[model samples]
Target: MPAVLVLLLLSGFLSRAEAATVVARVDLSSQRMTVSVNGVPRYSWLVSTARRGYVTPTGVYRPQRLYRMYYSRKYYNSPMPYSIFYSGGYAIHGSYAVSQLGGPASHGCIRLHPSNAATLYSLVQSYGRGNTAIVITR
Candidate 1:
C-alpha cells in the first residue's frame, strides 16, 4: 500500500511538471533568462545577447517557425536541431555548451541550454504552434 501511494504521488508530480507552461523572459542588462510557468518561476539561466552595439530588440513575438534540423555551413559548423525562429534571423535554439550563455555571445537570437531549449520547443509544439508568444525585454 505504501509503495502504491508513493508511485501515485510520483506520477502526479511528473504529470504536473510536464504540463507546465514555461514563459521565458530575458533581461539584457543582467544577462539572465527567467522561465516561469503559470506565473511561477520554474528555472533561471544566464544568457548572452548581441554585442554592445547590436542589442536584442525588445518586443512581443511568436514562434513563427520550427526547424528540427538546421545547419549553417557558412556561419557555424554545428547543426542546430529543434530551432524556433521567432523573428527575422533570430531564434531560440539549442546550444552545445551551457558555458556560452550569460554574456554578449549571440548575433541577435536567444541561446538556450540544449535541454532547456528542447523542453521549451516541445512545450510550444504541444501547446499550440502559433499561440506561444515570447516577450523579449530590456
Candidate 2:
C-alpha cells in the first residue's frame, strides 16, 4: 500500500511538471484576454486593443523581458508597472485607468487591470523570464 501511494504521488508531480509553461490568449475582435495553466483557464479579463486603424497584430510571441516599472512617452507622465515586454515595442502592462478596458484604445499593446497585471507579473516570474508564450488571434 505504501509503495502504491508513493507511485501515485510521483505521477501527480510529473503531470504538473509536464504541463505547458506558456498560457495566454488574446482575442482581437472581442478584445478579451484569457490566461490558462496547463490548458485550464485561470483568469479572464476584458482588454482594449489598438484603435481601428492601428489594429493589434495577431501572432505567437514569447515574453522576452520584464519591467517592474516602465513609462510611456505617449501618455506623458503616465507610467506602466509590472510590464511584460512581449513583442517589439508591445507589452502586457498595468494601466492606471482600467475603466477603458473592453474598448479599442491601446496604441499597440495589451493592457490589464493594475491588480491583474501584478498577479500576472508574479506568474511570469515563476514561469521564468522569457519563457511565457502569448498567442493573439482574431
Candidate 3:
C-alpha cells in the first residue's frame, strides 16, 4: 500500500510538470508574438523583429537566459528590460520605441512594448526555463 501511494504521487507530479509547458511563438511575417500555455492562447502582442538589412534567425529554441534588467553593450548601451535571450545575442525584450512596433525595426532582437515584455517575463519566470519554448517562424 505504501509503494502504490508513492507511485501515484509521483505520477501526479509528472503530469503537472508536463502540463506547465509554455510556448512562445514569434511570426516574422506578421511581426507578432503569441504565448500559449498547454495549446491555449494566453497572450498576444505586436513585436518588431530584425529590419530588412538584419536577420532574425527563425527556428525553434529554448530560453537560454533571462534578465529583469539588461543593457546591450553592442547596441549603443540601450536598455533591454525583461530580456529573454533565446538565440545568441538576440532576445525578446522591451523597447522604448513604442511607435516602431508592428514592423521590422530592431537591429536583430525581437522588440515588444515595455509593459507587455514585463508581463511575458513574469509568465516565463513562473513556468521556468525547463518548461518554456521559443519558436521563431516566418
> Best by TM-score, which number?
3
Q: On a 0 to 100 scale, what is the lDDT of residue 56 in model 1? A: 82
User: What are the per-residue Cα lDDT tens digits for candidate 2 across 1-138?
Assistant: 223223323645223333335467889889888887545578988888898677578876677888898997766856889988887778889887788998888888898888888888898899775446677888
Give the residue spans of candidate 1 off by over 4 A. 1-22
Clashing pairs in 3: none
- In model 2, which regions exceed 4 Å deviation? 1-19
Better of 1 and 3 by TM-score: 3
lDDT at position 38, candidate 2: 46
lDDT tens string, model 3, 1-138? 223223323646334434436778889999999887756788889999999899999876678899999999998899999999988899999999999999999998999999999988998899887677777889
TM-score of each: 0.73, 0.80, 0.85
Clashes of 2: 0
Model 3 C-alpha lDDT versus the unseen true structure: 0.84
Q: Which whole-number lDDT from 0 to 100 does residue 116 have in model 1? A: 74
